[model samples]
Target: MNLTSAAMIGRINPEALGASTLGLALYNTCLMFGIGLTAAISPLVARERGSGAVATTDAIRRLVHAGFWNNIIVVIPVWCLLWEAAPVLRLLGQESRLADEAASYLHVMQWSLLPALIYLVLRSLLAALERPRWAVVTGVGAVVLNFVLNWLLIDGHAGLPALGLLGSGLATFLSNLFMAGALSVAVAVDPRFRKLRLFQGLGRVPWRACATLWRLGAPIGIGIVLEVGMFTAATALVGHYDPVSLPAHAIALQVASFTFMVPLGIAQAATVRVAGAAKRAASARAGWVALMLGLGVALASAVVLVTVPEPIIGLFIDPSEPGAQAVTRAAALLLGIAGIFQLADAAQVVLGGMLRGLQDTRMPMLIAMFSYWGVGLPLAFVLVINNATTGVWIGLTAGLFTVALLLLGRWWVFSSGGRRPPIA
Candidate 1:
């Protein structure tokens, strides 16, 4: 839905698209911290569920409780970050007008963060319980509703106020609110969930369990922040180039993000299934299966991106529009870069998910930091001097490739019975 909105905004004005893109990049960077906490829930629940102990039901309930509180607590700081978006963007050297516009979008979008986190926690709950149909239903419904809301509010249809980018932000907030409410109702009314008593106790905070969740989740959160922060930094760097650079970067990123969603789903499933597997059965085999699945999807997507870059890029901007050729060309080139890195991207994410299944996060977080900031950012800074926006994409590709290799090596050792941390 965000990509769709960005496309629409890009057609209306490239600057709006750029501003919205920067806003969303920043939003996701901050949002991932809270999401990281919730991301732990699925594996934790899967491990408990794998025990096949009726007693583990109690552990599941406690984990769900912890997830809720963790999301709530983390969102507070995220909100503060959103509130200060303008100042932060300024410090990052974004154009003043673009920074102000992005900040306006963030101000409205921030209201959705808490609700979105709540929805994510519930989605994690459902994933752990192996009941994903409800999540699918709610997600589809939210996306459809967002489409209508953005159309009506962004351009002022049927006496509605035309809120431009802010309308898109409002649509996000409303759709998220709807998802949280609908999912809550679905969980509350479903007999399957009721049988497990997932929400039985709400009053107790269970500080110990929460602390354990934080201990396990902090690295996941930090890893996500570091990884996405690299892209955010790339967006900032790209913004300093010609006007077309930011919009083109945003368009290519949207396409890459869509491709990523496929592997991300596989990765999530890999985490749950692998985590649920008994220690005796948890080996490189499971990770390899997941990696192959993700790589297959990535390969297919890369073919589409490479063969039809113009049509794909055409989706976000009119080729016939004056001055749009440059943006389209730039985006197409970035998509080609995205295509080259798809395999590396798929391998790294799936491996990370497999490691999460093994209750490992801290080391992966360090690996990400080393690959992204220590390696990617510096490379991008140097290359951007001559390559502009393309430099950032190349740097990111290198980082992902590095992480993929390192993570594969780590998993190889773990599967070989080398020294490894105990599963959380």
Candidate 2:
């Protein structure tokens, strides 16, 4: 799902104009909810240490084992989603050929779900255990694999069939597999990780851990829904005006995805650092780590995007056609707004991470709902339907700000209150 939108935004023809884009948007909506499931895993694993019910290491080990299997459990829904992709594409008004193409793309991509989920478990366990550098290596490797295969498969290079959209899907599946296999191998070989036998068996911890995971994750997942949904909805709303506007919005979205990695990475790191600090009763350090990296990187990323919006956008847009001109204008509008959003995006994610560190997800979800649905969506509608692309930017920027403010308040309240102090 992560790669799905990127592929669509990067490669699909906007001029072709079909329901595929809208279908993809709906798929993304569901995928966003699935990601929320991880929020449940991290805090549950982290809290085991603070509660004195389980030693930190043991709790983390159990989480790794349980999480690996929990991923397997989610595969059922992944399969169903893939099976439904074609029908959904048809209903969205996609052309026959495009729907066929998308169905194949979705089918191959679904196989990645289990592996991606496995990698997610590894990431959460590693982060909650304060070993996030594990993520840096594995994640980079997976991304590289995705890109290389995208070129090969999409272009039909290296004796591989040129599957186009389906090829991109294949690339994504392979990338997830690479990450899961590499991480598993690394863990198996490392004496520290080996002792935990993270992959050995869940034995009896599955139900308890799954319950705990849902409890922590449901809210975080809802929060992601609101966040990702806001961007997706903006594009959809803009699409009402004309074909080019929405695709241009998608281009800007792709660009933002690349830049957003920083805060998202920092946020994950913050979640781990803060969770660890909270488990150790180190409130000051937790708050500092969560905000400091988030602040520095957010500013840096936003500035880069703002300063060279054209060049950054050029990478994703073909510069030689009339289509290019339309996209360039729309991309510029979206990027300009995105530059402003970087601040709030950074603040909100880091703020949420800080809350994750403190084992609070419920409030953040509420904040996201109010900010995106209550505020951003309505504002976007008024402006977008009125053909105010610039106003769409204003609405999204405001949403990000609202999220940041509310999330920051929650972080301070939870961390300062010390609701999750370590076992004394």
Candidate 3:
């Protein structure tokens, strides 16, 4: 969806793309809150199912119910923030026009947050149950739906208004709504998932279950916010630096984010696989295998980013356009830097997932805080003062590497020789 938006908006102008990118960054930062909180569903469900506990099915259903409530709780404040995004961006030192444009994007795009987070909760449940086929199908369909909507709405095809960035935002909103509804139907109809009765009692709060989710999920949510907030902060900082840098950074980051989804999926799978393991050695083996798979995919992604950045950048912006040369050049450089950190980024996320399966989140949250803020943000500030956009990415790379190393060490300590953390 971002790629589609960026490509179409870039055709309008670099400034438009920059504004939209900043809006997206802001929206995603807010989204991390819901994502982090609901992430507990998978690990909790997986562990319960693996434990052979009585009424495990009921427990898992209650977790999913709590997850939906949690989503509603998180989205309320996020919507408020996004509603005032223009002022917030201006306060962050963004240009007034850019901030307003970004805010307009957010006003419409923010509506997608609830549905998107709900989809995540459902997807996580499906993944935990190992009934992920429908979720996958729904996601692919949503992407295609988003693309067609983008083409029609962004440029006003089929007599539609040329909504530009607003159109992109609307497309996202509708696609997410579709995703959430489609997945719900899938869960309802599929014989395997229907028995779970995931949506049976929407009104029940399940206070104990909700409290348990918060206790375990808060650190995970906070850790994600810290990490995503760092990147969002970077985007804002780059936007403050120069016009071209914002769009450039957005394009590069989009490409990197697209690739990161590979390892992200592996990491989620790792969480489920490790959580389901019956023994310590089995868990250790699952973690290591997931890590290896993630590293291999990251390496392949890095090579592509390094080898053919221009072509990739071209996909988002017109290289032949006179105004785009600077943006293209800057994005290409940033893409290379992004490539350098692929392994670190992949390792950190995959390891983080493994640790989540172990229900070891609080320390990882501190590690993320220290790595991204204590280290990455400060270094980026120093470097950006000297090296412009390049400095910011270099600092980001350093932070990812630091977090990855720390997380790996943490994983080793758990896998080595110690009493395993109790499953919640």
Candidate 4:
């Protein structure tokens, strides 16, 4: 959906593309917090189901319940933050026109946060239960729906108003709503899940369970925020350049993020598989297999990015446009840098999930903070200050590589007969 929106908006104008990119970057920085919190649900549920206790279903139910409450608690402040995105962006040194345009996109898009988080909770539950088929189905459906809506609404097809950037935001909001609803229906009706009554006790607060969630989830949230915040900061720095730079950065980052979903899925599967393993050997095996698969996917994605940069860039913006040559050229260079970092990106994310299955989040969180803020952002600043746009991505590559190596070392320690990290 993001790719589609970028493509359509890019065709309209570079300014629109930059505005949408900045708005979405801010939105995603906030979204990662919710995602990290909900992520605790998968390992918790998976471990519980593997425990062989008769109350496993009840335990999973409590965790799911707590996750929904967590989402509610997290969304309120995030919504408030997004409401003032324009002011915030302006404070970050964004141009006034770009800030206002981005804020307009956020105004309509912020409502998607709650539903998107809810969908994550449900999807995590389904994945942990080994019943992710429906969630995948619902996700694919939502993407298709988002594309159709983007077509009809973004350009005012079917006699509708040409809402442009706002239309893209509305399409995303509606698609997320559909995803939450469709997944809810899938869980409610499936015979495999109905007995669990995952949605039955929304009004009741499970204080203890909620506490457990925060205890385990907060570091994950902070870690994700650190990592995503680095990217967001980079986006802001890029925004300080010509309009072409921001859209080019957006296009390159979007392509990287698109390829990342593959490894991310493998990582999620690794979390469930490792958490469910009855023996240390089984857990180690699961982690290794996931890493290999993630690396393989990363290699293929990197090859595509390196070899076919122009075609891919063309997908997002027209090179034939008078002002698009600079954007396309810049995006191609960034994509090449993105390709070089794909392996590091895959390794770190997959390793993070592997450690997460052991419920080892705090150390990873600290590592992310140091690698991104300490290493990546500072380097990016130095490079960008020298007027090197591609150097900005090189800094990102360095950061991802640092995190990957550090995370790999941590995973090795855990898999080599070291003491298990406390769940907290």
lDDT of 2 by residue, 1-424 (tens): 3443364335545542223344455555666555667655666666565455656556566656666655556667757876677676555444466556556666776677777777777777676666767667988888777878878887688898877666777788888898989888887788767877766555665677676676777678778978787876765555555555655676666666677777877777666666555344475566667687878887888787777788776665557745777778777877877878888888888777777766777877888999999998788878765665667778888888998988776666555654553211
Looking at candidate 2, the ten consecutive residues that score lowest on lDDT are: 15-24
* Segments of candidate 2 deviating more than 4 angstroms: 1-24, 47-58, 86-104, 202-205, 278-281, 414-424
- Name the best candidate (by lDDT): 4
lDDT of 1 by residue, 169-226 (tens): 9998999999989998898889887766766777788677799889888898899899
Which parts of model 1 have CA positions greater than 4 angstroms off?
421-424
lDDT string for model 4 (1-424, tens) is 6777788788777788899989998999999998998999998888876777554667878888899999899999989999999999999989999999999999999999999999999999888888889989999999999989988888899999999889999999999999999999989998988998888877898989999889888899899889889889888988885555888898998899999999999999999998989899899999999999999999999999998999999888866676788888888889988998999999999999998998889999999999999999899998887766777888898899999999999888778888776664
Worst 10 residues of 1 by lDDT: 278-287
lDDT of 2: 0.69
Tens digits of per-residue lDDT, candidate 3, 131-207, equal 78998999999998998898888889999999988998999899999999999999988888788888888798988
Query: TM-score order of candidates, best first?
Result: 4, 3, 1, 2
Error of 2 at 135 (Å): 2.3
Superposed on all Cα atoms, the candidates' RMSDs to the truth, in angstroms, are 1.6, 3.6, 1.3, 1.1
Q: How close is candidate 1 to the true structure, as a TM-score?
A: 0.96
* CA RMSD (A), model 4: 1.1
lDDT of 3 at 96: 98
